[model samples]
Target: MVGVEVKGTTRLLGLIGDPIAQAKTPSVINPIFASRGADIACVPLQVPAADLQKIWAGLKATSNLIGFGITLPHKQMAIDLCDSLDPVAARVGAVNLVRRERDGSFRGYQFDGRGFVRGLQAKRITIKNRDVLMIGAGGAAVAMAFALIEAGAKSITVSNRTLEKAEALASVINGDFGRLVAKAGSPRPQTGQLIINATSLGLNETDALPLDPGLLHPGMTLAEVIAQPEITPLLSQAQARGIEIHSGIHMIKGQVDLIADHICELWS
Candidate 1:
């Protein structure tokens, strides 16, 4: 395992979010940089939602800063700050990774959806032709829904606490895909081969489980996007029922290399 050796000339990369203590990007990304002998260090910064613009301006002024990762409340907000967005980010309506151009302008790209798909593939779980039931209609959920459609999921049923938000996301997805790929549904886990908890419900120890654990069956696959507790309550229940589970750590690991390559390209 290689280690990060910082110096005056080491390049800077950051993971920004409000309440960023749960971020695990550095632990997953820094070692990749070290292994490749790249003189870059990834750090976490807690930037409040109110101060994002001010902080973004300061980040642009730092010549050594190559790029940064966005999380939580800022992913959608960061999209407006970028000069351009990759197709994935544009479709997802969020930006999880931003690359600084030679002229110091920023370009945003989204990896959440791709990361989740890749994580599923790593576990030999196929999304193609499968019915997916996604909980939460937030940025992460939207990204995953788009990715699932792109990956050839037969259909996606999006459920959220707010039915309007879920309906809105489904409309956007169906419009973009030119088909009935997504539809708004109730929070109850629908009958689907794949079930995803894209909500933050599992982040806190006392939070309610995203869905009724009893709904998880032996043949179903469950996945989550909360990385802090690798095995979230929803996941634990699914595991106990002999259901296949994919953790948020898998999503992070799956994207680490892709993100490293993108940032290294900008630096070079």
Candidate 2:
């Protein structure tokens, strides 16, 4: 038997967000694509919320552009740009993955929620019947909460700097998931089995945690979805506290595989 040679021009995939310079997707996914013999190049696109639609619309006609992984403000905005939404994406109300079809129509999907669930499982973190205390109410926060519930979390308590935002996220989850253990108050949800820092609070060198470190116990597992600085401030605290820490790198890895598969399925 002889090996068949495979080769192609580099196809471009990108991540679009306001503070895109902080994104690690290009570094993470590019190597994976290269290892798989995929001639693809990934870039971080610093696209403001106001220009998301314009930038995406322009990509519709670009033949060399393969796909995009959305972030921040655009994750929710992408729902409006897609020709269709996958069921998970619809329920989460966020679209992190966009697949450009042969006809140039992009259908939106969300892999973050699903990826988080799967990544946790890969790490032997059981979601079923676990009490979850989720912090932050932004796109990533919302997705993590929903993913935990869908994976059969026993209870969930959400907290954010803005109580109203946390409550609003709870409303959407309650409407969709039918009775999650959501609340807003002081002391930060009493620290459940899992403590998730979904906020960007730990992204900066000087950012303090939304909750006091005394609230986090060694028995609980601390997970943060912030990719930059790899070892985030929250994870640093968790380490000193003797709590188990899962880095944002795992979530990024999960998305890389799914994103690659989505592009190959849709474009190849």
Candidate 3:
């Protein structure tokens, strides 16, 4: 750990989520602030979705609470609570970063999508002109697919338990990035260089891989968006077969940076 210049009066940032114990924000964001000589500390706040509005209102009233990193259910709710929203967040209809303005108003922005693209770049993965096979069409999945297309991915294939949900996300992506291939037919598509898992699958005892590991090839690189249970079952299976693996931790760090940038740009 690097030493940082901090006064007794330093401000704080935090993450708000229902199940925040497994989050990697503190581990990643705190070090980032320290290394950057910022007089700030990021913490984790476990707040359920039902209490989000109440908590957010109180947070806005507090002076020491510099900003917040929202997760899961809170992301969508934060958008509703914000006095203003960044265009990216508005388009995605979600907010993962929130900070108070000079007029005592709070604004929200979506950073996860930008972070996913940054994480891929940090790992030397190229989305431009690459065929992507994304598993899961959940919130994060939708955000990543949209971000990937914006980053110039040649084409994408989204797979989810419900084919219609996957098709919905694909439609949105196609609406922005040209023709996106949707695989809902009997035969699943097997051609893709990048395989990303944005599902909460393989995160707990009750969860399992969305698809079989036998389908993965060694040439394929996998990116999982689940951080808890660090080595998810999907990642474990991929490792067993020698497939390149990118952990959810990378995305956490990437999002932290994007949020920090937003804080400095808009708040500072």
Candidate 4:
């Protein structure tokens, strides 16, 4: 097996999330750095929700580090931790990428939505006028809801365990779009023409399905934001039922180039 050589002069990059073993960022991105002969390495940090703030300090103090990618719970919480945000991330209220400056201040950016849209487009999945049921009120969900609407999805229902969080996210999308294309609703599998699992529910075998599999019909297309276990339990169920399924890896694959370029710019 081949690997990038890490040495005293190698720069560092991190990907942080709970249950991070399922993440594909380091494997997907580190090779780009190697091919370009960049003295950089991306590593996964398995940080549960409770310890994010505790570790944020250590991340900031690492001089050899550029910044880290955020996922799951940290995506939203890291917004406050950032010294500034790209307007897209500010509007989405979640950050997927951060660049720590020489002064130790972190600037945040969100590319999840763009990547997701590009993924769907690349696969020729029709987004225009499709009613979407997005499960999750966290960072990735909020960003994708807006992207879906902007991509001409007929409407979107943001569903989450906490009803208020779902409602709040829908409200932001509607407010920003100046239309009622998004709203809070339960995760009823039959309601959406396109259903996306944006939560971290599929990271482990013990996690529950985001919705009732029995309700998934043949006409609907299902997608995800969880990159590992490409065939998540939900996707497996959907595929068994002959429903069109899209994997989470496509989302990362769609945007990895942007990520590599952003890091190269920062390094320069």
Which one wins by lDDT: 2 or 4?
4
- Per-prediction TM-score, please? 0.95, 0.89, 0.87, 0.95
Error of 4 at 145 (Å): 1.0
Per residue, candidate 4 scores C-alpha lDDT tens digits across 70-93 of 887799899998899999999999
Pairs of colliding residues, candidate 4 = none
Which whole-number lDDT from 0 to 100 does residue 170 have in model 2?
78
**How many clashes in each structure?**
0, 0, 0, 0
lDDT value, residue 197 of candidate 4: 94
* Model 2 segments more than 4 A misplaced: 1-8, 185-192
lDDT of 1 by residue, 1-268 (tens): 2368888999999899877888889999998888888899999999999999999999988889988999888988998999999998987899999889888889999999889889888888979999999998888888888888888899998888888999999999989988888889865665557998988888888999878898777777898888888998889889988998889888898898999999888673
Writing each residue's lDDT as its tens digit, candidate 3 over 1-268 gives 2454446677777788877878887777777676666778777899988888788778887787788888775776677789998888787777788877777778887778888889889999768888788887666776787788778777778877788887877787666554645343221325557888877777686786677788887777888887887788888888999988888888887788767776666433
For lDDT, the strongest prediction is 4
The local distance difference test score of model 4 is: 0.89
Residue 181 in model 1: lDDT = 83
Residue-by-residue lDDT tens digits, candidate 2, 159-226: 77788987888788887866646655443534447878777777778887767777777678888787
Q: How far is candidate 1 from the true structure (C-alpha RMSD, Å)?
A: 1.6
Clashing pairs in 2: none
